[model samples]
Structures are given as C-alpha cells and as structure tokens.
Target: MTRRTSTSIGFVAVLLWALLALFTVGTAPVPPFLLNALTFALGGALGVSWVTATGGWHKLHAVPLRVYLFGTIGLFGYHALYFSALRLAPPAEASLIAYLWPLLIVLFSGLLPGERLGPLHILGACIAFSGAALIVAPGPDGFTGGIGLILAGLCALTWSGYSVLSRRLGAIPTESVAVFCLATAVLSLPAHLIFETTYWPAAPAGWLAIVGLGLGPVGLAFYVWDIGMKNGDIQLLGASSYAAPLFSTLILIVAGLADPRPSLLLAAALIAGGAGLAALGSARAQRRLIK
Candidate 1:
C-alpha cells in the first residue's frame, strides 16, 4: 500500500480502540484479569490465524527476541495497570488520566530524530491536557483514590513509551503482532490463575464484548496501529488521539454507565478543536517543506 493509504488505515485502527473501551463498559461483570485474559487469548488466536493464512508464519521465528519482549511489556503493562486503575478509581476519571499517553507522545516524539515540535503542537497538547483535566477533576466529591491516579499515570507513561518504541520497531513486519498477542496471552493467563478467579462471561452481551475486544482492539487494532505509528503522520495521530477518551466517555453516557454532564460537551470541543489545529498546522508545515 502507498504510505498515505497505510497511514489513513492507521488512523482508522486507532479509532477502533475507542470502541474497545466502549465494549469494556458492557463487560463489567467479568473480572479484570479474566476479561483481559479472554480478550488477549482470543485475539492471539486470531492474529496467529491471520499470520498463518497470509504466509507470514515462517518469518515469525526470525523476529528479534527484543521485539517480542518489548511488545509483551508494552501491551501487557498498559492493560494491567489500566484495568487495575478502573477498579479503584471512577472509570471516567481513570480513563481521562490514562489517555494522557497521546499528549505524552506529542511531547516525546520531539526527542526522536527528525521529529519537530512546533508552536501548534505545544498549544494543541496543552489544550488537550486541559480538556482531560476538566473531565478528571472531581466535582463536589473529590477523587478518593490516590493509588488509582498513580496507576493511571503509570499506564500513560508505559503506553507512551510503547508508542515511541513502536515507531523505532516499526521496521519489524506487522505480522509480528501475532507473536505479541500470543505472548500477552501466555503472560496474562498465569497471572489470572495465580491471583484472580478464572470465570467465563455468562451473559451474551459480555461474550459479545469480549469477542469484539479480541477482534478489533486487541487484535487487528494493534496491527494497524503498528503500521500507522511507524509510517503514518504520527503527530496528527497523537493530536487526534485525544478524541478516544471523548468518544469513550460519550459511549459510557449513552450506555447509562456514566451520567451526562456539561463537562463532556466542553471537553469534546476543546479536544476536537485542539486536534484540528494541530493537524492543520502539520499539514501546512508539510506543504511548506514540500514546496
């Protein structure tokens, strides 16, 4: 595929993750470990099947050990901390904090060779942070869980580090996602056995959410995201990623899991506007450089 096409597909891939968060809302009855175990396990199976069908299985063994190791750390670490945070903090607040990874990406990307942090990038990131803060800041009832907030921050740090590393490792064939997913499953399963009770989702909706998470976010989403962060307009992706939380929060409201509030609308506007300005600036800079 052309670079543009690949990058466009990557944007779609990131957007799919928003849906993953949405589905998790419906699967609340499933314990965090069990929920993650099922999602990653099924997702691993699908990734393997896809790789096998595509004739990439032969190359899997050739993937560097570091790739597998780092992928496992990045993928497993983010979810583990994120899920744990959800149990302790309000999901909405926890998610807003976890979503800090995107802005972190914007800030961290500048440290990479050849990436620039222009005025618009900084402005956009600040705006997005403000929007998230607005969502996360407690109303009359202040946030009670300090540990949860810390976990969420760690989740952001872990995820941002992963994203930057993914760009460096983007040269690895995307099929290696099969390896990553399987590793996550192998790791998570034991954790579930050791610390958490293993139970399957009993309700149809819960099962559907698990299947959706496996297929979309945990499975194919990673495949697309790997390609995108490696080759796509990553700055644009990072700037736009602020929308994921907005979308997730909106989905929770629609699902009746979260109460509707004015902050939601304001947060959406700030995030959307900031992302728009950043993306527009990036496009302009690209045009100027091309000229």
Candidate 2:
C-alpha cells in the first residue's frame, strides 16, 4: 500500500483505541490482567481465523523465533507494566505517564534509519501532550516519585520502543501480530492467576464489551498499527496518537460517564491544532521525497 494509505490504516487504530475507555468501563469489575487475558484471547482468535481463511499460516512459519519473543514481550510487557504502575501510583498520574508513549514514539522515530524528526513534529507532540495532560492531570493528590513512577516511565518506553522497533522489522508480516496477541494472552493468564482474583463478565453488556475490545482495540488495531509503523509516516502517526485520549474523553462525555467541562474544549482545540501541524509536516516531507 501507499504510505498515505498505510498511515490512514494506522490512524484507524487510534480511533479504535478511543473506544477503549468506554469498553473498559463497560467491563466493570474485571481486573486488569484478567481483562487482558480475555480480550487478547479473542484478539488472537480473530487473527487465527483470518490467517486460516486466507491460508496465511505458512507465512507465519517463515518468521523467526526471536521475533515472536520480541512481539510477545512488547504486547504483554506494556500491559503488565501499566497495570503495575497504576496499582502503585495515583491513577491520573500513572495514566499521564503511560500516555507518554506517543511523544516517545515521535522522539524515538528520529533515531530510525530513514525517518527525520522535523521541528513541527516535536512541537506538535509537546502541544498534544499538554492537551492530554489537561485531561489526565492529577487533582488534589500530588506527585510522588517512587517505583510506581519509574514503572510508568518504563511503560511508555516499552510501547514506544515496540512501535519504533517494528519499523526496522518491516519485512515481518502483520500476520505475526496474531501470534503476539496469542502469546500475550497466554502470558496474561498466568499473571492474572498470580496477582488477580478471577472474575468473569457479570452481564451480557460486559461480555459484549469484552468482544468489542477484542475485535477492535485489542485485535485489528495491532495489525493496522504494524502496517503504519512499518511503511507509513511514523512521525505523523506518533503525533496523531494523542487524539485517542481526546476522542476517548468525548466518548465518555457523550455516554454520560463524564460531564462536559471547559478544559475539554481547550484540550480538543489543542489536540486538533497539534495533529494538523503534524499532518502539514508529514505532507511537506512526502513532497520533498517525491521531488
């Protein structure tokens, strides 16, 4: 696919992730690791079905074992670290730190072989991060530097590193994300068993939400994201990822889970402006390449 097409597909993952908060809310009472296990299981199943239908199982065979290990670690390590961070730190602070992945991705992409980190990209990422901060910033609870904060920082690094490294593995088929999801599910099961009390979805909506999480955010998001990271405008994708939290907050407001606030309006403007700036930067780069 063209770079533009791949980037658009990658942005679709952000849109899907916007629904993550809503679905997680719907999945009330399900602990984090257990939720991870369930959603990833379904995500893996979705990938398995697609691979079988397309006779793509052979494609997976060519993939190296190390790649599998890397993918599994990336997928599972992110959630494990994030959940652990939240447990030790304030939720708002933890989330804010974890959300740094987008900014980190933009910064790290500069280190990649062909990628250039334009000023606009960095500026846009900072502005977008400020917008996200407005939403997830701590309230009366002040910051405390400890293992929790360190873990949260690592959470950001893990995801950003995973995304940036995926670009180097461009030849790796997106289908391998299926194995990543499956392996993540397997790993999550043991983590949940060890750290969490088992609890299934109590109602049908909860179950449906679990399925939605699997099919959308946890499932197809990873695949399209792989395509984008591998061949699309990585800088633009990183900068634009800030929109997931913005859209997610909007979804929560519309669902009556959150009240509309003045800060949300300002945050919306900031995020939109940042994303637009990044898009301009990406377009300029593309034009330069074509010339």
Candidate 3:
C-alpha cells in the first residue's frame, strides 16, 4: 500500500479512539469496578467470538509476546489512571487534558527511531494543544478541577507512550498486537482477583453496561485502531484522531451529563480548526518534500 493511503486510513480509525476513550475513562471512577470488569470481559468474549467465527482468531496470537505485554500494560495503565482521574476531576477537564496526547506524541516521537518530527509537526502541535486548553479550561477559573487535571495529564502522557510504540511496530499485524492485549487482561486478572477489594454486582442491568464497555471501546475500538495503524501514516493518525474527543464532548452535552460550556464551543473550534489545518499543513509539507 502507498504511504498516503495507509496514513489516511489510520487517521480515520484512530480519530474515533477519542469517543471510546472518553466513555471508558469518564465512566471509570463512578462505575463500580464490577461494572467495568464485566463490561470488558463481555466485550472481549464477543470480539473473540466474532473473530473466531470469521476464522480470524489466529490474529490474536500473531503478535510478538513483548509487544503484547507492553500494549497490555500501557492500555491497562490508561484505563486505570483515566478512571481515577474522572473520580478526581470533571469530564471536560479530564477529556481536554487527555487531548494533550498529540504534544506527548510530538515529544516522544523524537525518541523513537525514524519518528522524528518536522517543523510543521511542531506548528500543528501548538495549534492542536491551544484548542485543548480552551476546551478543558472553559470558565474563568483558569484550569479549575485542580488535581483532576493533573491526573488527566498523567493519563494522556501514559497513552502517548502507547501511541509512540504503535508507530514503531513495523510490519507487525495489528491483530497480533490486539491478541497480546487480550492476553494481558487474562494475565492481569489473577492479580486483580487477588488484590482488588471492590464489591461484586448481583444484578443483570449493571452487568449489561459493564459488558458494553469492554466490547465497544476496549475490544472493538482497539482492534480497529490496530488495523488502521498497521497500514497508515503516523502523521495522519495523529492529525485526524481528535474526532473522538469532539464526538464525545458533543455526546456529553447532548446527554445532559455535561452542561454546554461556551468555552467548550470555543475549544471545539480551536481543536477542529487546529487539527484540520495541521493535517492539511502536514500534507502540504509532505508534498513539498516530494517536490
């Protein structure tokens, strides 16, 4: 496949990542541990079943063991921290702060071999981040939500590592990477069983939400992202992925879970404008390099 095509596909796939991320993380702290555990487990089962029926089950086992382990740990860390952040801060704050990931990617991109940023990447990063701060900092409080913002910062930074690692996965099947992540959950389950002191749910309604989460966000979403990344450009992946957060923010407002903050609208504009311009600018730069 051409570099351009891969980049475009990855951009679309990863952009949806924000919406699922907000769901998993925003709901994390408030939902009982049982809720997420069940949700993820059900999703995992459903995902595996779908894959198996399609004879794509081997995709799960196709990745290198180390890649799987890192992904698992990295993903787990994001979930745990993100949920905890929700408990500590507002969803907007948490979501906006987490959006700082592009910046994280920019910084970390330098450390990874063959992933160095061009000057345009820096300009795009600035535009993207300015938009993030606007969304997150809505209201005169100037970054209210205090410690929660800090926690979200940490969460974004952690996921940044995962994103960086993903770009480095040359020729590795996305499915293999996913299988490794699922295996990580299994590997970590024993530890969770041993140390997690949360109460168990005895009802089916609560159980449904739990399962929905894992399958929709963690399982299906990750799989989609993996496939996109394997065949796409890193810059495209980064540029277009903000759609997830934008979608989530809109959902929260529609659900009445979040009051529509005027600042949020402003943030949305910045994020959308910034990300769009950045993507376009990157395309232009790539063209210049070609010329």
Candidate 4:
C-alpha cells in the first residue's frame, strides 16, 4: 500500500492504543505525578532497549547533549500540559483543542526563514480553530468551556513548538530522537517525588495499566506517529490525527469518565468531519498529480 494509506492505518492504530491508555488512566486511582513518571520511564526503557538491540542506540551518544536537553525538557512540558488538559477538560474537547498543533506548525513554518504558509495551509488553520470552538464552547463549574479551551490551546502551542524544533533537527535519525525524548524525560522524574507521588498501585491491575501506556501509547504510538508524520503529508497528518481524539473520547464513554453528552459528541463530529474533508482534498490532489 502507499505511504498515505499505511499512515492512515497507523494513525488509527495509535488512536486505539491511545484510547486504551486513556481508559487505563481513567480507571487507575494513582496520582498524576507517580503515574506520569512511571508512564515515561516504562516507555523510555522499552524504546531505548528496542533501539539498542538493533545497534540504533549507538547513534544516540553522538548526538550533542543539547539535543537531549531540548528533547527531554521541551517534550516533558508538552506531554505534561497535554495530559493535564485531559484531567481538567472533556476528552473530546481536549483533543480538538490540542490538534491546533498542526496549524501552529504551519504558522511557525511561515515565520521560519524558508518556511511559508500557502492557501491550503491557511484553510486548515481556519477549519481547525472553528472545530476547537465548537468542541469547547464555554460551560460552568470551572469545567468552563473556557478552561478546556485554554488547556487545549496550551497543548497545541507546546506541541507545535516541539514539531518545529524536530523538523529543524533535519535528518537526525528518528530513533535517536525518540531515545532523547523518552530517555531524557527522566529529568521530570524528580517532580514526581517533589511535586507529587512516585509509586503506583502495588496491584496487578495497576501494573497492567502502566504496561499499556508504556508499550502502546508511549512507545509504539510515538514510533507510529513519527513514521507516519515524517513520511506523509502535514495536512494529512493533522486530519488523520483527529482519529486519536475520537477513539479516546469513545473509550472515556465506555469507562464512564465522560457522559456521551451531545455537545461532546457533536464537537467530535466536527473535528472528524473536517479531517475527512482535508484527507479527501489531499487524495484528489495526489490523484491529479499522478494523472
């Protein structure tokens, strides 16, 4: 199959895995600190081991320490913010808002020396923002649509910066960068102890939750996203990523963390619907080029 088809499939797989991760998080009574640290540590060990087994780890030490610092510290903030938003906001709303990452990337692309936004890029920004608004329209009880909007906006900004910086790293080995992200995220481990708890449930069920996160969402999901995103169209990347939110919210419904509230469901439809349009546009353009 073509790269785009493969990527669409990969994106869907990642979303399903992410949904499982969300359910794990929802069910676990663990504090966020302990949960997030163990979460990254498990994923980090797996990623590092996977790369090392195949000699890919050798490329890592050659990378400047700065790369690790940037990858670790920068990504820590992004993931932290992303997760916090889910804790504080509705799943679907958080996903819709977080997706502004691609639009931010396009905007940053325009500001960067050689990066520039085109008509399609501008179109994407507008569509995505509208979807976000629909998803997070203000509510009360501090679950204010406003709060969700803010948190989601933060995730998008941080992730967008991560994307731009990663692109700037040029042809750096993808696996090496992944190592830096997972390995160095350890810097945030201390925060688990200082700012929050460091231990998870001493139960089989808790361990299982950690495993799903580390292996699936944390380790495997990143690999899929990196492979799909780096090798596929950016707009298609944005559109395809909508799958993650939809799948995640669905999982939340099954877990009862979120009601199948009409607003949340409709908002999800907007994001998914917009994604379909963009994906269709990209496909038609590709077919025309081949023709």
Q: Where in model 3 is the C-alpha error above 4 Å? A: 1-5, 8-12, 25-36, 54-63, 110-116, 134-143, 187-208, 289-291
**Candidate 1, superposed: residue stretches over 4 Å from native:** 144-146
Cα lDDT tens digits for candidate 2, 1-291: 998899999999989977866786677667778888898999999999988899999899999999999999998888767656755654434545566677778788889887787878767777866775665555455445357767877988999999999888999998999999999999999889998887777899999998999999889999899999998889888878877656776777788865566765676667656766776676788789899
Task: State which candidate, 1 or 3, has the greater TM-score.
Answer: 1
Give each model's whole-structure lDDT: 0.78, 0.80, 0.62, 0.62
Per-residue error at 121 for model 2, in Å? 1.6
TM-score of 3: 0.80
- Residues 141-192 of candidate 3 have per-residue lDDT tens digits of 5656777777788888888788777777866765554454455456556656
Per-model TM-score, in order, reads: 0.92, 0.87, 0.80, 0.81
lDDT of 4 at 271: 61
Please provide, for model 4 over 151-194, each residue's C-alpha lDDT reduced to its tens digit, 9 standing for 90 to 100.
76887888778766665664566576466556545666677668
Evaluated against the true structure, the overall lDDT of model 4 is 0.62
- Per lDDT, the best of the predicted structures is 2
What is the TM-score (0 to 1) of candidate 4? Answer: 0.81
Query: How well does model 3 score by local distance difference test?
Result: 0.62
